[model samples]
Target: MTAAKLPAIGCEHPMAGIARRTHARVPPYAFYEGRKQDWRFSMADEVTLVGQEAEGLAARACRGAGATEPTTRSLVAATMSAALFGPPTLGFPHLVDYLDSFRDGRISTNPQPKLNRPFAAFFVSDADRGIAQLGFDQAFDQFVETVRHFGVAIFTQTNSYTAGELGYFVRRLAAEGIVGLAATNANAMVVAKPGGPAVYSTNPLAFGFPMGDGSPPMIIDQASSATAFVNIVAAASEGRSIPAGWAVDADGNDTEDPNLALKGALLAFGGRKGANVALMVEMMSAGLSGGPWSLDTPDFRSGDVSPGVGMTVIAMMPGVDQAARIARARTQADRLAGLGVFIPGVTGTSKKEQLTIPAGVHRRIAEFAANAPAAGNMSLA
Candidate 1:
């Protein structure tokens, strides 16, 4: 699970009840990892670079205040995701908000919603979060419980959206029993096995599933890289080697040394198999979406300039046949496993279905989610 503190995430204030249609490009800076020395003072400088309004910053500070006892160290890493992934995603689920809740889920968008032209009327869904993928019975309960906890209900879907379009979907997708999952693809963040610098980050993916029993699987997220790059960078910052297989060094050689690994490229999952998957992710993320992708380009933070990395997401519906497919797959697969073979994606579903969020993350969820606004309103200031 992402163990970092969420960043103080805020957006350009929406003018009127609606915003002037502005198709924005990716921001050119990495996420703001709040600094150690005079951080707010430092941010005053970066905010100018970001060009977000003072009102927005005020909003963020207000949102950050609720943590009865908020900590800078805790919030720094968490907030970093917000700064990095926010713009390209059009503020779907703020990275800080999602990371604050999920260690595994992701963010994504539908290109059709982003198109712009002269004298054209565009309609963003009245709903923003795509939690619709979780269906009604489940999403409603989650919303009720979450609002009871966080004071706000961030939307979800099998697709991407903004705050403006989040609510309607919550009601609509719930009626049909469709599971909603709202997630985003942040900067191409990949952690390879300390050596080979082949492609982009393993990237992060988030999902939400609804169930009649308990909360069901409302959220599932993962990094597409070898290991989460945060861990890799953390190891590097500590001058430690990443657990072998998570990174590599210059010249494509596997090295456990985190510093070298940080300097090198991370390997894709499943070796060639994982590379194929990462490639597909890259295509969907950068290729199909027209967002920045990890090309032969270098990390912009460094002089090494290659293509920047990004993400792409596709949402699917289990529909009325979801159960049938699961049952049939399970029966058929059981028969096969009895004979020595097994299923591929089924394992993923099994783990996803597990109740308690799998790691130390649940406590964090209970803590933050509990105090979040009933509408999930921002509270810090």
Candidate 2:
């Protein structure tokens, strides 16, 4: 989630205005290649099955982050978490970096999830390629083929929800012309000690939208982080840093050096406000949904030492009229434009009801589900 404002530097221009103003400063091309590009997936008879498979993959990734060829479950679990954050049309670099971490292991394994469910995946990120796309190709056979063959490239969730819950929500929402989206966030969850340590990497915000199209309303899911930590790690290993404002040092200073920032903390978008939103996400992702919290826990940012965070899911039903919602949104947006370019969040009331946008998925090991590990559900000796 690239912020359009620069409050850190005392510059708070409108996002679109700023982008337009700066367009001439940069290249004259669309940054994304996947815009308007359809992410066609096999028409699986079991969208629910695919969703469950995605859920399994998310959980397994945290536990089985070390496998050379992780089980379908593991890969899906890891990838889903990451995918929920970026635009649905995420760039290849972002997706690859996120997936690579599963092989390395970054998720935690404590204070397990109390809930878990299948969610329809959808989003769009603002990446170099402009946006990332995800979809379930048509046909159940195609789904099986992809899972068994190319393997799911990425799996993303914005918040915590059981596979069944997510599946039900999306299916119904789509029927009602709304989009449904879900994602999660996690971190070591450390309480900052003033001039000492920084902690907590709350997950992203989960969004569920009722479709607005004859098909389904698109989802505009996201988080506040510029990129996943995996990308930062890759850059560091290759002797590089991030774009800017992605991180800050412990002493309240921003740094392009990923290593230094890693030693410090990931700053929230609007400082304390951003941190507050992060906290909301943390509570929703982990706290409200049942994951980890730094309020009274060890820091996970110190490297999987804490019990990890959970997720936050926002399901929006845009009613049964897709065209009306779009028209209303565009109208309201235009009205707001009468004042000036409306703020980013202002334009998307119904727009936010969408789930599939553009951009990016996959990730590392995490402790448990937003609910609980299914072990307790099984009969014990």
Candidate 3:
């Protein structure tokens, strides 16, 4: 039960050294009576500050690419500030390449194998445009199809692009009667607190479940940060200020100034617990998937290199009485609704329409749209 008795493995990251020998803390005696139980013990705090990469910037990479598309006018408006100011020079080429990947589902790694195992690994190399565009969706659909044949599938993807809207993938799968859960790590942009070093990305996580109705599935997606970095950038672009505790200044002091916060770091949603979740995500996305740790990935804002990140997707098949299970879940949801407990994402899923953007943000987006090169034809130089 001590650290010295645990197994250890040599790794490039400092935390990995600690991780190798830490699994023995939960002694073998912890198993249940007459049966062996599964247990996963992780080192969640060691590497938190080592090189937490910029997940906010990674989110911006997808937001920027989506904004450039003709079909994403509203998205463009919402993210105009980031496109115009955040990494206008270095982030553009990466965005363009990600968009190009959408035209063809050709990624470095393909998921064409059997889904019989409970876990599978999928790697989308930086080559062939990575996980941008609809490539991930295409790959995920294939995963769902294969998993449905089996009972459950847990797939991890490394070396992928910045995955935007992690819930979108799960929602569609839920509609197909497959429950889906997903999480992706980003570059470092958040801290444990104002005085603490920024050690983790506001890693986004999502889950979707089928309701057995023709309506949209029940989906919930959220970032671990106090607020998504994109919103702060948008607010800064409009010369607005953020609320206290959302971000810190360069000296690690609390600040409402968006610009100052950008120079500093974002605050985790709930102190150590949020940081713990971020680390959990980092392990699943990068640690387990053979992807670059957040600290090792290139900075998405000014670095010309691709954001080498990872995503984890899990698909679960229901039992033979699937309809009955779904009906029971709906009944619970109905009871909660009757008690005035609102379900997240229920209303937004049923409605699809454009959201209004600030005049300044909209104007900036218009200018960028008019002057930008074709997504596939962009150049880093």
Q: State TM-scores per candidate.
A: 0.40, 0.41, 0.60
Instruction: Go through the candidates in order and give each one's C-alpha lDDT.
Output: 0.34, 0.34, 0.50
Superposed model 1: Cα runs more than 4 Å off = 1-176, 179-198, 236-240, 296-311, 321-381
> Model 2: per-residue lDDT, tens digit, 1-381?
111211122222222232333222111011122223212111111111133444443434333333222222323432443233223223222223233332323322111212122322211111111001111211122323332333221232222211211222233333444434444444332222223344544334434433234322333444444344434444455578776655665574667887765555544455566666656656555444444453433322122232232333333434345568755754654576588763332333321222321111221112222222343432211
RMSD of 2: 16.8
TM-score (C-alpha, index-matched) for candidate 2: 0.41
Candidate 1 vs candidate 3: the TM-score winner is 3
Model 3 residue 361 lDDT?
Answer: 23
- Candidate 1 vs candidate 3: the lDDT winner is 3
lDDT of 1 by residue, 290-355 (tens): 445554333322222212233222233444465564345346655765777633222223321111
Task: Quote model 3's TM-score.
Answer: 0.60
Separately for all candidates shown, the number of backbone clashes (residues 3 or more apart, or on different chains) is 93, 112, 7
Off by over 4 Å in 3: 1-128, 132-135, 230-244, 256-259, 301-303, 353-381
